[model samples]
Target: MCSHYEAVNKPERLKQAFQVAMPEGAKADVWPGYTGLFIRRPKEPPQEEGVAPWREAMVGSFGLIPHWAKDTTVCKRTYNARSETVATKPSYRDAWRLGRRCIIPAEAFYEPDWRSGRAVPTRIARSDGQPMGIAGIWTGWRAPDGTIIRSMSMLTVNADEHPLMRNFHRQEDEKRMVVILEETDYDSWLDERNAEPRTLLKQFDPARLTASV
Candidate 1:
């Protein structure tokens, strides 16, 4: 469960990596309930045929705000949705069933390492220093005031067998890591045609990641 992460925070990087414009007032760091950027399928398809943009980047709360939520505080607990239950969980099932998948771009994410009998905050980033495209789900919740609140949640899977990811969190708990999609899978992930894109929720390759305390 990742609650803190370093966002891309650069216009050039966002354009080059995701080919989407940077969201207005995007933050450098994101935490639960904070605003962050997510890339999802455009609401309208391209009218032209040649090289149409397939992704649309938008700023939203780091935690997901379901339609039934009374207020925005629910985001704090909905930031990370387990992949196994996303399709059935009340908070995330709507987005999952509607194929509202997204990509959460980040430079790095933080986790706690408990190898020494004490929790030590650690940073995990790609070994190559490229931005990461984490798999997620997004939705728009209308508030009582008629304002639409957009939010998203990172999708995670069991990582007990992962060589690198298995090192984080408490040893007594099941190891888990966010689903980081491959560069080539970006468009496919945002495609709404695949109602249940469970195949794309594969664990990230640990060899490409480096962790430091």
Candidate 2:
């Protein structure tokens, strides 16, 4: 699972790489070179007639609470969702089915490995240097005092035979990588009309994605 990412370029660079509209009033958080789109659930009331389009929001470094949780600490354990069982896991099932569908824009992510007991960090990005869309889920949780806390988590799947990730992943433990979406599948994945897990899962194609460490 990706724990760090870098988007050192301007938002315009991300726009060009993803070919998507640039987010308005965007700000940069450079500690980890964080840029690109990070999404959260809207605080507005749910529409009675139709589903509202996913809204964007900036989240803190380590906070991701589910809507129904009594406390926010659960989020710490939920930074990443395992693809093999996310659809059935108690923490992610509801969000995966109906509540949360989001895209995390990223340029490159960092992976660390223990090489001879030393932590060696590696940067992973596309060879072409295109922006990538990581699949995620979000929720809107209400606090006791009526404050609504929005949170999100990234989804991960068995890693492909990508040479870059092999060094970080274990041979026996199913290798895991973030779920990346293609241009054509973005709409369908975000469309509330098609929230079925099967339909969403089919949109991911490992062949179009390339990584370098």
Candidate 3:
């Protein structure tokens, strides 16, 4: 599960990268519950029928709390969605079917390696230094005060055989990594034409990534 990440880029840079205006205040490093940038298809009003659907970069809580969830507390339990079961999981199935897909850009992510008999934090990023756009799904949640808050969950795929990825995570746990996409694939990711996003879910090339304790 990708529990933490850094997205220090300001609104301008994020705008340049995605051609959309990003809500200000993204943090250098965001933990669970921290607000971060998420790119999603815009919600066009019924009156603007002819206008094209554009992408928007918005601030969203890191952990996703389904609309039907009892409270924000449930977000703590759904920060990551397993790719294999995302289609059917109660907490994620609605958004998955409704095409509430999003792209979560980050400088790097952290994980734990239990090779030494204790969990050791490891930093993983692209060797080239370019930020990665991880696949995710977003949902709209309503607060007790009748305010709507958007939240997201990163998607992960099995990577047990990945050399660099297999080294992380406990030996007893199933090896997994967030589905990182190529910059060229970002547009396709935001498009609704691709019904099965899983077809693009893949483990990034280990050769292009750097992992250190």
Candidate 4:
């Protein structure tokens, strides 16, 4: 999965790239060397009609937390959701069916592969050098003291036999990659009216995308 990414551009640049206004007080987070649009629930969801507005503290990092978890540590292990099983997995089933759906914006992401027994890191982004929208799911957890924590996870699907991705995903294992969406699919993917998995999955197309280092 896309464990590392980059959004080196400033928040204003991201806004200009995506053609969306920056939310008030929204700032860039570049810690861990992975920069991208960082959002909290109830505040960042889309405000347009048919678009699901982001929550202020409802969407945190790209990791998911099941509502039943006793603590937040589980989030560390859920940075991605496998599309093949997300619709049925216990931790994600309910959320995928009822709760939160979001988009994570990124200029590019990093993936590592073993080259001659040494790890080689490569950066992947659109060949056209445009921004990408990664599909995600969000969850809200309430602490004992009533502090609520919101988190999210990127969704991954089998990578196509693209030249670049093929080098990293060599096994039949459910190799994960971010769910990249096209501009025309954004509204439908965010529509509350189209919550069904089949409907949402139909909006993704790997053919239109190209990846490179």
lDDT score, candidate 1, position 159: 94
Candidate 3 residues 1-213, lDDT tens each?
788887736655665566666567666787778888888887662233232247777788888889998788777778899989998999999989888889998888999988999999999999998778889999999988999989999999999999989987778888999999988888788887787678888899999999887
Best by lDDT: 1
Predictions in order: lDDT: 0.91, 0.59, 0.83, 0.60
Candidate 2 accuracy as lDDT: 0.59
Q: Report, for all candidates in order, the number of backbone clashes.
A: 0, 0, 0, 17
In the order shown, what is each candidate's alpha-carbon RMSD?
2.2, 5.6, 3.4, 4.5
Q: Assess the local accuracy of residue 110 in candidate 2 as a C-alpha lDDT between 0 and 100.
A: 71
Encode model 2's per-residue lDDT on 39-133: one tens digit a residue.
44445533433333343334432334666677877866776888678778888888777846776777767766544465577766655657667
Model 3 spans with C-alpha error above 4 angstroms: 44-53
Q: Which parts of model 2 are misplaced by more than 4 Å? A: 7-9, 14-36, 39-63, 115-117, 160-162, 169-172, 195-213
Relative to the true structure, candidate 4 reaches a TM of 0.75
Whole-structure CA lDDT of model 1: 0.91
Ranking of all predicted structures according to lDDT, beginning with the best and ending with the worst? 1, 3, 4, 2
TM-score winner: 1
Q: Could you tell me the TM-score of candidate 3?
A: 0.91
lDDT value, residue 28 of candidate 1:
86
- Tens digit of per-residue lDDT, candidate 4, span 113-212: 6534655777777766777777777777788899876667778866655445555643544445677777566555655567563445422344555545
My TM-score estimates for the predictions, one after another, are 0.95, 0.72, 0.91, 0.75
Which candidate model has the greater lDDT, 2 or 4?
4
